[model samples]
Target: MLQHLIDQDEGLRMVPTDRNELTTAVGQLNEELRGLPEEADPARTRVLTRWIGIGQMCLGNHDEARTVLRQSLDLAAALGNTRAVVATGLNLGDAHRYAGDVQGADALYRSALNTARSHHPELVDFALQHTGKNLMERGDLASAKAHLQEALRLRITKGDAGLVESTQAALARVELLIGRADASAADGAVPRQWSGEWTSWLQSRTTAQTPARWAEDFPALRDAVRGLNAHQRVYPRHLRDQPFPAELIAAMAAEAEKAVAADGYLHNGKWNAPVGDAASRFAGQVDLAAVVARSTGLEVEQPHTAVYIAYLEEGQFLDFHVDEFGFGEANLILCLQHERPTAAPSVSTTVFITADGCLECDLAAGDCVVFDGALTPHGRTPLTAGESITLISLGFRARDQASRTVTNLPPVPR
Candidate 1:
């Protein structure tokens, strides 16, 4: 009857139902366990404990889940139940993952993988799936993709529709991000010149923001980035040189003019700008999108919002503000034209407020800047009378944090 109940619970586990049913089930199982002799059936006890742990996890009681799952795993190991050990180990890993202990979860998953590979080939996919998910959350996209791809390949041969579909879906997500990261290199958009100073700066900045748990993996990641084709290598966050070829820039400028003429400028209490049809099209291009993603060191999705051409006229200025989330994490601004009356030392500078201090960037025609605009406070100095500037603004969202809404974030105070 207890085994029967366990089977029933497994079948109903994923069904959307009242939590009270699960709570009652847990209580009944515990009561039954207490009635059994200490040695009556260790196997049954292990199974019961494992199910209870799973139930606790479902209830969001991760601490309780971990304790019980650990006990179950020990019992399974003692009984030489390789299958049970692999299964329970995965559950324990899941408990850790849910509790935000990714490192702990990864260790358990790796152990499960080894055990399953040696004795339970059928269970290998489960181990791979969990490990892949854990690594992806930890920002190790390359490893995650490889694991998921392998799992998907195995699942397809198993001929289980549900399992195959689940793995496929996970693989698809990993591929999307991998494709984004690989786009720039594949498109031959890597900058012609890369400075050692810039590489050092990028390495420091990337390392500083990376989670401490990922410290050990940084060297591997750095080497992998370096190993990529010139077109495949990720670019530095801030580049004084243009990513696009001179010919491409000229063509893009022409398109910008046409787009502005068609869409006209719209004032949104921020600046006068026209819908950047040309910029949007170019941004959506695989090469440009890849460059944007690589430059930010983030796997990004195609821009959902339209790009814009900010047509700043004399006396026009932009207030310091961070771009909205989802649509503005990484901002790329291309200066199509900057005309100063009499060319009197141009004061049309772009300013970014950083922890270090204020960074004043003076952009000339054809120059561009790419930065984390979603979190960084930035703005433009007012244009002097008879001064004018044209800029194409493009934004991309980190794939992991993609959202359709353009959150109206408040401006940062100077």
Candidate 2:
């Protein structure tokens, strides 16, 4: 009854930004904690303590959150609740991260990861995801991407749409920073003559109203729709995967290293340095726009002036975000180089938010993943410790934009 009252009073949500709500939630949580059986039930006390700490966090009281979460962690540890331990660790890590202690946050996340890995592998993704997010904030893009990718791969395997969407958004943000795709649209500016099918599709999906398949001929699309009907929204569909010859991959990697070395990286944001010409030498021969159009059923022509390439060493990652629809209708990504033939290799993965589900697909050195940039949400995971990723992105204007011409303003320097 007390718990129900607390939930009702607090709206079963996070601490509200409104001063009255915050105070009320905190006070109610405190009252509940006081009433919890102290010595008779350690487990219950730990859970309530954790909730209070989370409430404190929602109110931006990191110091109080840390104290309370630490105590909860201790109790959970004593009770042998490994999952709770992991959860508490994550909460505490967030408190530290928000308090501007990156190292402390990393340590806590790593500790949680280790604990999860040993006793509860299913919980490893949580630790990795939080760590990746922290790394992104600390300017450690490579590590951030790597961790985020690991977490995303796990979430994909688990078929969790909500987690997958959130992670994809993080990865996408990282890519935009590196690719400088937002150069044309800064300051949250929307295009004057822009219309995206995503919003309408999102609305339809919300009401469980299935729409016509853009690519009815593709089994992947059909299967995705079937899964959507079954309430599964994290489907994996690979339109194509053809392995490039080892020699070709080597040559491409060599050119990429040289070009990035010569041109340097353009930093428009936090995580990535944009390389507009990662594979200019092979641009004419390899146009995957047609493949994208066929698979996604969107007319994407008029390739952007230059392909955006990102050269990421270990520890770098892209955050999740949707592509700028105003700049291009769709995005065609080609993985130029990835993974080493060593004993233990790390593969790079891309997470996508489809109309009905989430797609987490791994990319090899020669593979390509194409989707509607404006409509679907997507992002890439970080590279392995010793491995690096050199990939190129080609954006295509919508078919409707062919007849209409406007002076495209370049992205501003941040």
Per-residue lDDT of model 2, residues 130-229, tens digit only: 8777777666777878888888999999999988886787776556554553564453354332222323333333321111232342344334334222
Q: What lDDT tens digits, residue by residue, belong to model 1 across residues 255-353?
A: 656655665556532333344324533544436556676566677666545444654466566645444443455677777777777756656677654
Best by TM-score: 1
Clashes of 2: 27
In Å, residue 215's CA in model 1 sits off its true spot by 37
Error of 1 at 321 (Å): 17
Model 2 regions lying over 4 Å from their true place: 1-19, 180-414
Q: What 10-residue stretch in candidate 1 is worst by lDDT? A: 405-414
The regions of model 1 sitting more than 4 angstroms off are 1-17, 176-414
**TM-score of every prediction relative to native:** 0.44, 0.41
